[model samples]
Target: MECARKDRDLEAEQALWQRWQARRDAQTRAELFDFYAAWSRVLAGHYHARYPHPLAEYADFVGLASMGLLQAIDGFNPALGSRFKSYAEPFIKGAVLKGLACYIKDHQQTSRERLLSVAGEAEEGDDLATIVNLTVGLAFGYFLELGILDAELYDNDPASLYERENGLETLAYLVEQLTEGERRVITGHYYQQLSFVQLSEMMGVSKARVSQLHGQGLQKLRRLYEQVS
Candidate 1:
C-alpha cells in the first residue's frame, strides 16, 4: 500500500513538471527556479566545501548550479527511473567545473595554469588539490581518472555479467574496507552530497579535518582499488 501510494505521488510530481516544462514561459521558469533553487544550494555548497579554490570565485559555482538545475528540470523525464537529485546533481556539478576554467582564466592566470598542470600527475602521493583539479578538469563528459569520483560516474547495467568489472562496483567494495570515520567522510561527501561545512558540523569536527578525512578516505580507496584491479 505504501509503495503504491509513493508511486502515485511520484507520477503526480512528474506530471506537474511536464506541464511546467511545456509552458516554457517566464513565469513557469520562475516557478521552476523557486522549486529547485534549494537543490542548487545543496550542490553548490557540497562542491564549495570540497574545492575551496583560493583564486576562484565561489559565486560562479552557485550561479552555474542554478543554471544546471534549470537545465535538469527542463530536460528530465521522470519516467526514466532516475531520481531528480541523481539526474540533476551531475549536471549541476559539471557546470561548476567547466565554469571554473572560464572564471580562472579571467581572474587568475597562474592558478589556471596550476590547475591544468595537475591533470597529468597520478592521484597517489599528490595533494588533495591535485585530485580536485583533475576532477574539475575531467568531469565534463569525460571519465574521472581517479578512484571514488571516477567510480561514481560509471553507470553499469545491474544484470550484466561484466558488472563486476565496473569501476564503481569495484569502488563500492573498497569502501567496505574503510574505517568508520573514513566511510562517513566519503559517503557523506559524495553520496549524501553534504558540504564539508555541514559534514564538519554533523561530525563535530573542523572543516579542515573534514577535508583531511576526505583525502585520507580517498587514499585508502585508492590502495584497495589497486589491489582489486
Candidate 2:
C-alpha cells in the first residue's frame, strides 16, 4: 500500500514536470528570437571584418541567422545533454556561409557585365529615365529567377521606430547629407523596400541605368554614414 502511494506521488511529480518543461520550452523559443534580433548586428560585424565587399550589407546574414536560431530552438534536446551554443554555433556559421555563397555567385556574374557597360559609357551623359527602367526590369527578373513572387515582396511592410519618426524630416536630413540622386535612390530602395525594377519603371529608366544610380546612391550613403560617425 505504501509503494502504491509512492508510485502515485512520483507520477504526479512527473506530470507537473512535463507541464513546466513545455512552458520553459516556449519561453526559451521566444528568448532565442530576441537573442538573434540583438546578435544580428554583431554577427554582421564579424562577417564584414572577414570579407571584403563594396558595402556592409547585412540583411541576408540576418535572415539566415534567424532561420538557424529557429532551427536550434525546435531541435533542442535537453536529454541529449549538449549545450545549445555548441549546436547553434555551427548552424549559424553555416547560415552565414550560405549567405556569402549566394552573394559571391551574384557578384561574379553581374560584376563583369556592369564593368563593361560602365567602360563603354564612361563618357556618355546620364540618362536617368533609361537607367531607372533598366534597373527595375533587372531587379524584377532576378527576384523572379530566385522564385520570389512580386506579391510576396510587396505584401509586408514591417513598422520600425525609424520609419515612424517623421519620414519626410528624416528624408530631408538624408538629402542634406546625401547628393540629390543618392537621397532619391536610398529613399526609393532601402527605406521603402522598392525593388530595383519598380524604381526603374517608376522613373522611366532602364534596369542597368537604375543599377548605376543605386550604386552611386549607396556610395553617397556610405560616405554620409562615415562622416556622421
Candidate 3:
C-alpha cells in the first residue's frame, strides 16, 4: 500500500514537471511555483537568520526566495531523471544567496556614502518560534560527500532561542551554511533517522565516513546552537 502511494505521488510530480517543461508557459510555470514555493521560504529563513538586516522584515527574505523559486522553475530540466526538488534546490538557493549578497553590498555601499553617524542601538529579541535541524558541513570545510543523498550545502544564537522549541507547527526553516554533501548526510542520518550504515549505503561511501560527518555535524550543531537554548 505504501509503495503504491509513493508511486502515485511520483506520477503526479512527474506530470507537473512534464507540464512545465512542455511549453514553459507562464500559467504552468505559476502552478509549479505554487507547489514548490514553500521550500523557498524554508531555505530563505536560514539566510535571514544568518544575515540579519537591521531594517528588513522576515517577508523580505520570502520575496528573495520567491525570486529564486521562479529562477529554479525556469532552469529545472526534467530529462536528468532526478526529482524536480533535487535539481531545483541548488538553483533556488543560489538565486537567494545572490540576491542576499547584492542586498548586503548595496547596504554596505550606501553606508559608506553616508556622512551622518547614528548611535549604536541594542539588538532586538525574536518572538517567533523556529523549528530547524542545523548541521554545518561542506561549506565549513570538513565533511564527506559520496555524490548521492546530499541535501545541502550548511545558522545563529538569541534567534537560536526560538529554534530550540519542537513542533511541526513551528514552521521549519532551512540553512545552507554547510556544503551540499555535508547537509545530505546530516539530514539523512538525523532528520531521516537513518543509521550510519544505512546512510553510508545510500550515499555510496564507507560507514566510517558517515560516522565522521555525524560527529563533526554534532560538534557544529553544538557550536552554532543557542547558548541559552
Provide the TM-score for each candidate, comma-separated: 0.39, 0.34, 0.41
In the range 125-161, model 1's lDDT, one tens digit per residue, is 8888777756654342122223433223345567553
The alpha-carbon deviation from the true structure for residue 207 of candidate 3, after best TM-score superposition, in angstroms, is: 54
Error of 2 at 54 (Å): 4.8
Ranking, TM-score, top scorer first: 3, 1, 2
The TM-score between candidate 3 and the true structure equals 0.41
* Model 2 ranges off by over 4 Å: 1-28, 53-56, 104-229
lDDT of 2 by residue, 28-112 (tens): 3433444343454455457656764553255445545555555665666656767656777677677667756765424543434
- Candidate 1: where are CA atoms >4 Å away? 1-15, 105-229
* Alpha carbon deviation, residue 41, candidate 1 (Å): 0.6
> Which lDDT values do the candidates have, in the order given?
0.60, 0.49, 0.51
Q: Which window of ten consecutive residues has the lowest lDDT sum in model 1? A: 138-147
lDDT at 146, model 2: 34
Instruction: List, in order, the clash count of every candidate structure.
Output: 0, 19, 11
